[model samples]
Target: MGVWHRSLSRFFSPDEPHAAEPQVDQESNLHLEKPISEPLLKAISTNDLPTLRALLETQDRQLFSQIAQNGTPEAAAYLLSRHTVPEDYSQYIGSADPILHPTQYLIRESARYGNAPLFRYLLTQYPAIFSSQRWNNESILLSAMQGGVGIWRVILDYYPAWKDAEFAGHHGCVLEFLVDRDKKELIEFLLQEGLDTDRAGDPVLELARRRGAGKEVLDLIRKYGG
Candidate 1:
């Protein structure tokens, strides 16, 4: 994020001299100037969730997404509950401009943190963000897997593109990890989705079973042909 130079309005600056001096200060300085949205930066740092909610409610949603990457994301999530996600969320993010902010930060923070309501709002408003196999590799589906089936429900019911993404991300079909560490029902949900066994050579049910997942879950996996 760079400084957004406010262009002088010709109507208001008709008599004001064009900046022949190049607008550079003569005095030498060591400190960098504030970026354009410094106030927004300051507010999020201060955890001013109310103000954040209001500002995001009015600004382009992608700006909010960018802010999420650098700001107090937990507070932002709280604020998101109070605001309505723009119906045009994708339009704000999927720009023709290649330099536009990346969508990963927003998706990772909102979805991975188990902010079910906020995730739901974003999924409904910005389907393209979740239309791929990739979660931020840093936190990834590991979050949703740990969050709960309710969280999965929030994703699936709202994000129509999620199933394909899950498949592409090695098909979020198998619960090969510790089921005891997370709710068992998520495995069942994946099974019902017609998830096949043997995801890229990882035997879906046996992996979890080997890891001490309950026989009950393993049986469900077998029922699903894992």
Candidate 2:
């Protein structure tokens, strides 16, 4: 995984215990006399497309995920739409492994924010972003799965190449995300894709059944599993 890992110290920092968001006001913060790094946050929050573009071009790839987690959802969406790589994208392909560079940046940030516009842009402008790996050894499919139906719909409509939407897993195919939101139609769509009640590829179902998932959730799992 090319993803950057946050320091253990940062994780446990009592002063900044990982607020749900990076900063509230993304616009005014851009002009504050704080620091250079502060602008990145501001640019993201305010949806300053040009500033985000400039920063993404020059920023270190390793810090991509941190930016994703820290940037405002608005700015993240803006930058993701503008991301591009060196002309040698395919040249790097023949190498043993691949690095999608800025495209990966967009994917990570879009996943973090669940921004439909940004995700859709990637699927259109940079189809290659879908192939980029996510953290925890998951694919973009897993990203959408973990993110729930909003993400799922965004990916499905824009990224038709998602052949593994409901691949086999512990729950066969019923362990899809959106448990709290009860994405029943999404589950049914998965079933239409060929995920039967068997354990061929139903991690969602496996998770629900093994954990004694609620009746509605189980019904969803089985409904799709069948």
Candidate 3:
């Protein structure tokens, strides 16, 4: 994972109990003073690329910041097309405490929506941000797990070290998160990826049982000798 791989494109705070997740709504509150036109909001929410392009042509710097905060892969792709992402692209969006970088905001949004292409595109555009030590935290990977097995697989494919990364507080590992959420497919995937079920904090089978997981999940965990 150096500065530029030939496969180029193929690439928070533990305060509140749910701090491991991005407080999207709460964080958005910090940006209330920033003026974003309604049409831009609608285009971002509806993923109307043409409208976004038309609007972005003239808006000030705040435009990209707002897009980074709310837009998806479509908007990201388009924005990246116009601007050469700076090395310090991990910029602060709000001028308040507990501020999160726009890059983090975008990554969380990409993970939440399972937008692997957007994730990869951003990785290629800003390898410095993606490979930075500060960004490789547990909560970010937890967000990817929350996205589902598809994005989880994409993430691990790029950052293999996170295959067994531990999550802080509850849901110690991806295995535990999948079990708690009764994500059968992801459980099977992680088990096959060599996650030791018994070593993933608690006994996988028991945790699944306690979480009222279905027989399929239980059986999969047991098959891996959980």
Per-candidate TM-score against the hidden true structure: 0.44, 0.46, 0.56
The alpha-carbon lDDT assigned to residue 207 of candidate 3 equals 74
Model 2: per-residue Cα lDDT over 1-226, one tens digit each: 1111222213222333553323537653442323456677799899999998777545544344444444344444444445454533222221212125555444545554565555565566655544533221244554555455566677556544452444434332233443444655555565565543454444656655665656876776665553
Residue range 1-226, candidate 1, lDDT tens digits: 2221122111121222531223446331111243436667877999999887666444545445433323233334443444453433233332312123323445455455455655565555556555432433213355566555666777667543443343334444325542555455776786676544556666766677666877777788688786
TM-score of 1: 0.44
**lDDT leaderboard ranking:** 3, 1, 2
lDDT winner between candidates 1 and 3: 3
Better of 1 and 2 by lDDT: 1
**Number of the top-ranking candidate, with TM-score as the measure:** 3
Kindly give the number of clashing pairs for every candidate: 0, 17, 1
Q: Point out the higher-scoring one by lDDT: 2 or 3.
A: 3
lDDT score, candidate 1, position 134: 42
Ranking by TM-score: 3, 2, 1
